[model samples]
Target: MSAVAESTAAFSAAASRELGEGTNDTPAIAALRSEAVALSSKKAWPDSRKERPWKYHNIATLDLGRYTPGMSASNGAAAGVRSCPVTGEHAAAIVLENSDVIFSEASPDGLDLIAFSALIDGRLQKLVDERLGSAVAAGTSKLTALHYAFLAGGVLVATAPNSEFKEPVRIVRNYSGGGQFAAPHTLIVTGANSRVHVVEECRSDEGDIVVMPAVEVLPGPGSVVRHTVVHRWGTNTKVYTEQRMVSERDSEFVSLQIVAGGGVVKGHLESSLVARGSSSELYGVTLGTGNQHADFFTTQDHVGPDTRSDLLFKSALRGHARSVYYGMTRVGLGARNADANQENRNLLLSDTARADSDPVLEILTSDVIRVSHGATAGPVDEEQLYYLQTRGIPYEAAEALLVRAFAGQVLDRVADEALRDELSAVLDARWDSPE
Candidate 1:
C-alpha cells in the first residue's frame, strides 16, 4: 500500500481501539460507526489531484500514523491550558478537552442543553437523525467519515419555541497532549420564533496534535441565530473543521469566523436558506505568520424563493505563510427573487507570502433578483503605509497598523462588544508584520 493508504489504516486501527472504551455508543452512534468504518477501510485519502476543492488544501503529505486517538489524561483536566476567556458573566460555558466533556453548564430558562448521546436516546431522536449528517454528508471525505465513526463527547443545545436568551451560549474546547487526535461535534437547534447567540472558542497547548471538529445549526421558522467561532491552535497542530447552518422560512442566520493559529488549517463552512424569506450573512477573517497554512471554503446555497445571502472573507499572510479561500453562491431553480453576494480579499505582508482566492456564483434561475461574486489577492496598499509613515510611525509599525485596519472591518461587525474587544486583543498578539 502507498504511504497515504498505510497511514489511513493505522489511524483507523487506532480509532477502533479507542471506540472500545467509550461508554455512550447508542444505536444511532452505532450506525454511524459502522458507516464510518466501512468507508475508512478503503484506505483512500482525498484525491487532491482530481478534485477542485482539495486542490488548494492537500493533506495527503501528512503522516496520519504518527498521531493516535486522544485519550483523557489521568488528571481529568486540560493542564497548561488557559481558562476559557468567555466567562459565565455573559454566557453559559461548556468545556471539552480531548473530545471529553470536562465541564458544562445548564442553559438559562427556556432552553435545553444536553449531550449528543443523550439527544439520540431522547424524544429528539428523529430530529437528530434527520439533520445530524445532512449538511456534511458522511463518506464524502476520509476525515469526515472517520470523525463520525469515532465520534466522542459533543454538545447538543436546543431553544424552546418563542424563547430568547439574554446571553450567548459559549463552548470552550481545549486540545492538549502531543501526538493525539481530537474530534468533537456541536449541534444547535432553534425552535420557531426563538432567538439565540452562540460562541465557540478552540485552542490548544503546545503539541503536535490534530483537531477535527464539526458544527451544525438548525433554525426553525422565523427563528434567529448568531454564532461566532475563534480558532487559535498551537503552532504544532493541524486543524480540520466543518461548519454548516440551515435556515427555515423567514429565519436569519449569521456567522463570524476568525482563524489565527495552526501549522496547517482547513475549514469548510456552508449555509443554506431552504425556505422563503430566509437570509444568511457570513463573515470571516484569517491571519497567518511563520510557516502556517490556512485554507477556507464556503458555500451559500439558496433553495427557496425570496432567500438571500451575503459573505465577506479577508486574510493577511506574512513570512512564508500561505492562504486560500474558495467561495461559491448557488441559487436553485426554485429560488426566484433570491439575492446573493460574496467577496474575498487577501493581503500579503512579505514577498514569500502567497494567497489564492476563487469566488463563483451559480444562478440556476433567470428570475433571480441579483447575484454577484468577487475576489482580490494583492499586497498591502502602499498609499496607506505611506500615510501612516508620514505621521512619524516606523515602517514596520505602519504596515502592522494597516494590516490591523484591514482585518478590523469584519471584527467591528461583531455584535457583542465584550467579544469584539477580546478578539481585538488576540489579533494584536497574533498579527505579525515583516521586519
Candidate 2:
C-alpha cells in the first residue's frame, strides 16, 4: 500500500477518537473521519494514485509529552527572532513553536504584546474568545480538533485605540523538533481608527516532520491592518492553515502570504466585508521546487454597501512540484456599489510540474456595481522566449529573465520594497532560469 494509505488509516483512527467524543459528540467531525478513511483508500482516477511525496511531514507524529502545558522555552527563542522587515526594527514579542507556546512576554505600552492566556484576563479577550470557535470550531475538522487537544499557548495582539505603531508588531512562529505536531493560535484586535502593521513569520527547525494548524484576524472600524505571513518551513513539514478576516465599517485590511516552504501545505483564507466603505486587499505568491506542494483557497464576501476588494495570487512551480488555487467572490443583498475583482495566474516550469486555477463569483442582488473573477494556467510564453533568445541572450538566461519578469508583476504591487525584493530573490532561486 502507498504511504498515504498507510498514514491515512492511522490518521483517521486518531482523528475519529478526537472528533467522535469532541464537543459532546460532533456529527460533522464524525463525517470527516469517515471521509478521511475512504480518501486514504479511494482514488479519483484509476491507474495513477501517486503517493504523497513527504510521508514525514505530518505534525501528529510528534511526542506530545515533551511539550508542557504553558509557553515552552522556544517561545522566547521565537520572540528573540522578532524583526521588522519594513523599518528594520526589533520588537518585544512572543513565540510559538511546534504548536507549543514555547516563549511569552507581557511588556505593556510599547506595543500590546500579550499571550492568549494574559489576553483572556485583559478586557479585549472576550472578543477573541467569543469569535474563536464561531468560524473554525473543533467540529469543523479533525485536524483542528487535534490542535485543540494539543495546544498549550497562543499569541494575543491588540492595537490600542487610534494608536499608530511606528514599528510593526511581529508575531514570529517557528517549527522545530520534527515528528512533532503543533496547533498554533493567534488573534489580533485593532481598536477603532487605529492603524498598525504586523509581520507573522513561520519557520521550522531541523527534524523529521511537522504539522501546523492555525486561525483568524479581526480588523475593526476605521482601522487599517496590514498583515504579512512568511512561510519558510522545513522541506519535510506539512502545514494546515485556516484563517479569516472580518472588516467593520470604514476599515481596511491588507494581507500578503508567501509560501516558499513546506513539503505539503493546504489551507483556506477568507475576508468578509460587513460594513459600508470597508475595503480589503489580498495577495499571495507560492514557490514549489522539487516535489513540494502548496494548495490555497480564498473567498471575498461583500456583505455591506460600497465595499471594495481586490485579490491577486501568483504561483510558480518547477521540477516535479505542484500548486493549486481556488478563489471565489460573493456579493450579498443590499450591497450597493460593491466592487471586487480576483485574478489567478500560474507558470509551470517543468513537464512534471502542475497547477490548477479556478475562480468563481456569486451575486445575490442585481443592483451591485460589479464583481468578477478570472484564472489562467499555462507554461512560459514561447514568443517572449524566442524574442529574448534572438536578441543574443542564451536560451537559459532568456527564459530565466522572462520568468522573473512574469513573477515581478506581483512583487511590484507590494507596498514594501524590501519585502518585494526578498520575494523576487526567492522566486529566482526556485527557478534556475526566470524564463
The deviation in Å at residue 46 for candidate 1 is: 1.8
Name the 10 consecutive residues with the lowest summed lDDT in model 1: 76-85
Per-candidate clashes come to 0, 17
Question: RMSD, model 2, all Cα superposed?
Answer: 7.4
Q: Write the per-residue lDDT of candidate 2 for residues 337-360, one digit (tens) a residue.
A: 899999998888789998877787
lDDT of 1 by residue, 1-435 (tens): 676675665567455545734636556666776777677667477778986667877677767677766456437463533554456444477777776676666567777666664554455666566667766666767778767766665677778899997677888877888888777778888899998888888888788888777788889899988888887888888988888888889999989888877888888889888889999999988898888888888889999999999999998888888888888899999999999999898999889999988898888889987898888888989888898888899998898888889999988877777778888877887874332
For model 2, the superposed segments whose C-alpha errors exceed 4 Å read: 1-92, 99-110, 117-121, 124-131, 206-208, 426-435
Count steric clashes of candidate 1.
Answer: 0
Model 1, residue 405: what's the lDDT? 90
Q: What is the TM-score of each candidate against the true structure?
A: 0.91, 0.77
Candidate 1 has what TM-score?
Answer: 0.91
lDDT of each: 0.79, 0.67
lDDT of model 1 at residue 397? 87
Top lDDT model: 1
